[model samples]
Target: MQPHVTTALQAWIASWTAHERAAQDVMEAAFPGLKPTPAPTGCCDVQMRWERDGEGSGTACLDDHGRATIQFEDVPKAAVGHAMTEVFGNGWFNEGPDGFAGAPPGKYCWEDDCTYAECEIDIGDDGLAAVAISYVKIEDVVAILDALETGLEAVRPSA
Candidate 1:
């Protein structure tokens, strides 16, 4: 991973941890009967793996709880649409913005029994393209993260 992207991911993780702490503090203050759930040591320390393919390279940032973001780099706008289609299925695409003559790009969400995910796209003349896959739900996230970690570690060192 690039230094800047790694830094950004670290910052993102820190923000999530701080927000969680703040929220828990408020809950504890409000409800004396509320029990604090102890997070495992270094639970916030995520292992990220980067993979390169013909389409683009991606970074999979996995937290211990199994939540993750597989962020693709330098993907074309058309490929982004195709990926979203694969995630949401054939008919689910184009359900967002029409991408008409003046309509701006759109964001769409997909959810199932175990997880919720979203895709955001930006299409314009600036020549920037990107795509991402986010995994939600605590258990599902953790399982996916663990599997990816194990698989990647077998092939290369994880940073």
Candidate 2:
């Protein structure tokens, strides 16, 4: 990962140690070889990338003065879909009643006070999908990542 991205991700992760720790357990359970970078103080952002055997690859990033962004390139569509359903409840992503076959990508957004967050699912050319979450508030960032972590855990076996 680039230095700036690394710093950004560090900051973001550091800011959410409690949530990060819980997610770490989920991540470890799902992908044993994967390791997360420590979040030290003065870290300005959350930007890093990693890949592990038996697990997929992804990037987490944020600029010095912007919202946090995460992308899991090789994530299993089913796992992420299940996570989204669990996190946001039903009716969040409109894939029709039949499910993903002809469903377009899902998009959802919400705001609370001064913070805003957006979640999306991007389908790659390989027919696999990646989950991307961006948010401004620290809580939203944690919630998004936690949902992802929980979601990934939910689907780890099949993945």
Candidate 3:
């Protein structure tokens, strides 16, 4: 059953790419500076065992909640966090953009219900942020970003 769901998600994403250019255009229109990159890795397979990326790169699957977060070193968690929030749920951080609570700071925390979720990848004392390229609903991403664009606050990458 779960495998079928995963298969369906993959098929959906693949189909998305067929007309992805259009989606990209939409995403671009929403967040002009930000770009949606191809997912470097896909769903977990046999080779994707749960483990730490000792070299500062690794993937962690919070399967119980139907989500995963891949950590990266020196990747500017805040920048990514703000970008994701602005893109998905307005500029909601620490809490939601519109009174919607943001995901708490930590390694990614998949929600209990597993409906719409997010994860934070802590960048030291800064705060918890996301790990992956981030998987979010297309419409949500677009709506939130459109709002954020109106209130741009350029975040300089961590030095």
Candidate 1 C-alpha lDDT tens digits along 29-146 = 3322233433332333443333444334544444454455555554444445443443344444354453211224444334444456654444545433444556554333334334
Please estimate how well model 1 matches the true structure, expressed as its whole-model Cα lDDT. Answer: 0.44
Model 1 residue pairs with clashes: 66-141, 66-142
lDDT of 2 by residue, 21-108 (tens): 5544543444343455556422433445667443467766554544555667676666555556655655555655533323455443
**1 or 2, greater by TM-score:** 2
Measured with C-alpha atoms, the lDDT of residue 159 in candidate 2 is 31
**Deviating ranges (above 4 Å) for candidate 1:** 1-46, 49-58, 90-114, 124-128, 137-159
Q: What lDDT does the true structure give each of the candidates?
A: 0.44, 0.56, 0.42
Worst 10 residues of 1 by lDDT: 26-35
Off by over 4 Å in 2: 1-44, 97-116, 124-127
Residues 47-104 of candidate 3 have per-residue lDDT tens digits of: 1212222212333322222233333344334445555555544433344343222444
- State the weakest 10-residue window (summed lDDT) of model 2: 39-48
The superposed Cα distance between candidate 2 and the true structure at residue 78, in angstroms, equals 1.5
What is residue 54's positional error in candidate 2, in angstroms? Answer: 4.7
* Alpha-carbon RMSD, each predicted model: 16.6, 9.0, 10.0
